[model samples]
Target: MIAKAYLWYGVYIILNVLTIAGSDPSGGAGIQADLKTFSALGVYGATAITALTAQNTQGVTALYPVADYIVAAQLDAVFRDLRIDAVKIGMLANVENVLAVSSVIERYKPAHVVLDTVICSSNGYLLLEPCALAALRDRLLPLASIITPNLHEASVLLGEPVAADEVQMIYQGDALRALGAQAVLIKGGHLLGNCSPDWLIEKSGHTRISSVRLKVIGTHGTGCTLSAAIAALRPQNRDWTNAVNNAKIYINQALLQSTRLSVGLGTGPLHHFHAWW
Candidate 1:
């Protein structure tokens, strides 16, 4: 097994994270957003592109998936070189991609795997193929250390309506855990409220993380940013709760400052570099 904590010259080295996901030429979501989040959080980032998407803040025009074997090769090459501290997985376009990712996760067994269960885009674009949902639920969900699914994705996974309140949110979180995930974080950003809440359920316990609902136009990539923040912080924190707490704070700030950017015609993106710029 890889060392739980890395100490080089009596100082903890920078955490290395891999984003085994798709490419968004828009630079606001998917692999681009993941890499930006890693860099902003002082984590070294590596990537294994699963697909390439033609998308922008407004909408997605087209999507082209990479071959499953090629995706596997990229992951193998990274594992052979870097001590990948955490992995943030997004958009697995098809069943082949899902199975391929699950295979590598089983082989290398990264210490932390934050699965961003991105089923569709905010603009109503389908990111993961409908046929792949079963493969993801059966093959990939079980392998994740924590699965971060927004309310809609959670509903889709559970075949139920979206949670309307905290009680229902917790209920959904519990139900997701029953599906074999080690932990579940159900994001309630789409809920109608002045305060956005996220329910994080783990073996140790669960916590309700709430923040002021920052109304900003640059709301794209919030999912990628949040999950990436958790992945980037997990290696440095004492436990998952501590990591998630700090990640919420980071995302709150990102949302608070999102209006500083005006990149796209539609929703734009959260300010991933808010800490720096």
Candidate 2:
């Protein structure tokens, strides 16, 4: 009986991360990628799916958003049972879903929240509805511990064109931080250069984490993976900057290792289990 009790205690002590996002049937992005990332980083993953996508390496063909009440119920179920250590949010499809998630965040107040502003898919399919942008910016951004936005999403939030260069990215990062996120990570994957730079903006200052751009094609789900990694790492490190840096390093490695994986004809996904293999 004592041995069984210890075993249960050990199971209960494992770190748990909740990913609230859309579902990707291809297992390359959305909740799929987030779950892979959490597992790769040694954190147990739970999920509250907000949408479902018929997507693959090529592109997103269709999206079906889950009902708001169902989304809320999923979150409630997770929080009430599991002691969630961190949360990573992605791909909220509409205003109702956004508001539903926002209300749950306000209630649970999870230790770490990484919001990956997935406005659109890489293949130019709109993931978040146009009307939901206002609710996301107003209600969700403030509750997040960090907001990770790619250059294009940052532009959408800022109501401007894409940042011209690294300087403009920094400026945009600051502007995004002002919108209420405790920190902003402006990803530079779209930037044309030999290096990919991510600008981290906080109230204290900003940091530029630059890595040599890997010449690889299978780079899908990089943003989702990065944010999920940060969420998983933040609770252990307790420093947003370090968490971001570590996540970047992990992503770089994943990109490098995933080059040979020919999953699809178009853009492919990062090798989430690169470290393990």
Candidate 3:
């Protein structure tokens, strides 16, 4: 009876969601976006900052990367005590950082791992070097349960131009699977079309979801938040497909609700708090 009481008491302790990503001073993307999305979805978030960028809604002006050892230390500290339920990985600014993060992930082997292949910014700036992308493809791709990459990043991964269309996205999805991701989500926001289709493909099959184009500008952190939401929901024991779909619904609702609200000077940030109020 005493053992049962201890078990019950401990089971209700803090729920931690881990995120590995960069930091945006503007609070629109990277670790900030992931944490906000996790909290909005009723989960606790912890982060290992990979890089620091000085940027606003307009664009990134400069970047400062954290030491690789420090990145590893953050993960070590978090996994030591926290009952981390899931993990979301974002921008790894360099090759060394990517390898370090991959090593930690393999060691801990968390319940769920979501990889956001943030190789570039929305404004056409390269976030990672060529070597870093190669490291991610070789080291991290196989470890991730699911990887979310926008068009530009996908093109870089596949070594071919990914057409911004259904056929192309599916083709690239298959290619990503070939690269060894357990699952892949190819975001179609870069496509110049009225309907934006996000493809979620896995080893079993493929699923495509379409949303009306959000007319709002400055939607900097939508991808980061969406991926984080998926990571946070994995603790509910839903499969990858369900998790991705639910995350899409959450992001679409958030975008629709905050279509008119402006948070930054340039390319506005998503209205993350719209539903909270």
Candidate 4:
């Protein structure tokens, strides 16, 4: 038994990271942020672009959804070539894209699956169409190890805007669990308050996390970065608490550093590479 345990441990260490998220032409969010997080944590990152957006820190202007078959092909190519350790899904813009990625997840059953429900742009632009959301709820939610939804997405998923309050957030988690997600990480940024409180609710129990409200006005790809950090760290046997805590620390530092540099003309992206300096 000891020898077998040691072997398993060795396997885990060797396969530390893999992910599938959308591409951000702006390079502030989506796959760019995910890959940066993975690299920062010393993990290899992989991705399958779901859609392409023509926008930057300011807002998304135009989006072109990748064809369903192309999305499937990207996953197949990655699976055939690499030993994927974990997956982080974001920004499925259409029903076909959702179905395509969900089908792949069902087949491979990666060790860790983090879903950053990118339902809309940070500026309140609709990223996922209504039909796509329907597909996500019906096909994808049940498969995720954890679904990270901000207040707006959580409210939309439950058919109502969950009041942005502590008591209401807990209820929102329960409502999401009832919908089939094994775990719901309701991000508290949208809550109208001085401090943002993020909550993680699971079958066994719940936990609350908070950070002093950030002063930075531009936060473009923060969600994607958070989800990717969680996925990258999860394969190392870190619990969700540890995963989220570390992710928050990384994001906070990036945001603080990013506030100093002017990136885009509109809303700027988190300074993902700031750690180097």
Candidate 1 structure, TM-score to reference:
0.95
lDDT of 1 by residue, 24-134 (tens): 888988889888888888888999999999998888889899999999999999999998989999998999999999999999999999999999888888989999999
Report lDDT (CA) for all predictions.
Answer: 0.88, 0.90, 0.83, 0.81
List per-candidate RMSD values in Å: 2.8, 4.1, 4.2, 3.7
TM-score of each: 0.95, 0.95, 0.93, 0.92
- lDDT-wise, the better of 2 and 3 is 2
Kindly list the per-residue Cα lDDT of model 4 for residues 1-277, writing each as its tens digit. 0001114544534444555666778788888888887777667777788888887878888888889999999998888788787789989899998999999989888877898888888777788989778889878998998999988888888798665598898898888888888788899887776888999998989999899889885577889888888887676654878778777888888888887777788878887767776
- Deviation of model 2 at 188, angstroms: 1.2
Considering lDDT, which of the candidate structures 1 and 3 is the better prediction for this target? Answer: 1
Give the TM-score (vs. native) of candidate 2.
Answer: 0.95
Query: Of the candidates shown, which would achieve the greatest TM-score relative to the real structure?
Result: 1
**Candidate 2 per-residue C-alpha lDDT over 1-277 given as tens digits, one digit per residue, 9 for 90 to 100:** 0001113454645578899999988888889998888888888899999998999999999999999999999999999999888899999999999999999999999988999999999889999999999999999999999999999999999899999899999999999889899999999988998988889999989888899989988789988889888988887774888888888888888899898687988899999888777
Query: How many clashes (backbone atoms < 3 Å, residues ≥3 apart in a chain or on different chains) does model 2 have?
Result: 0
Q: Whose lDDT is higher: candidate 1's or candidate 4's? A: 1
Name the weakest run of 10 consecutive residues (lDDT summed) in model 4: 1-10
What overall lDDT, based on C-alpha atoms, would model 4 receive against the true structure? 0.81
Per candidate, the number of residue pairs that clash is 0, 0, 2, 0
- Model 1: CA > 4 A from native: 1-6, 9-12
Order candidates by lDDT, high to low.
Answer: 2, 1, 3, 4
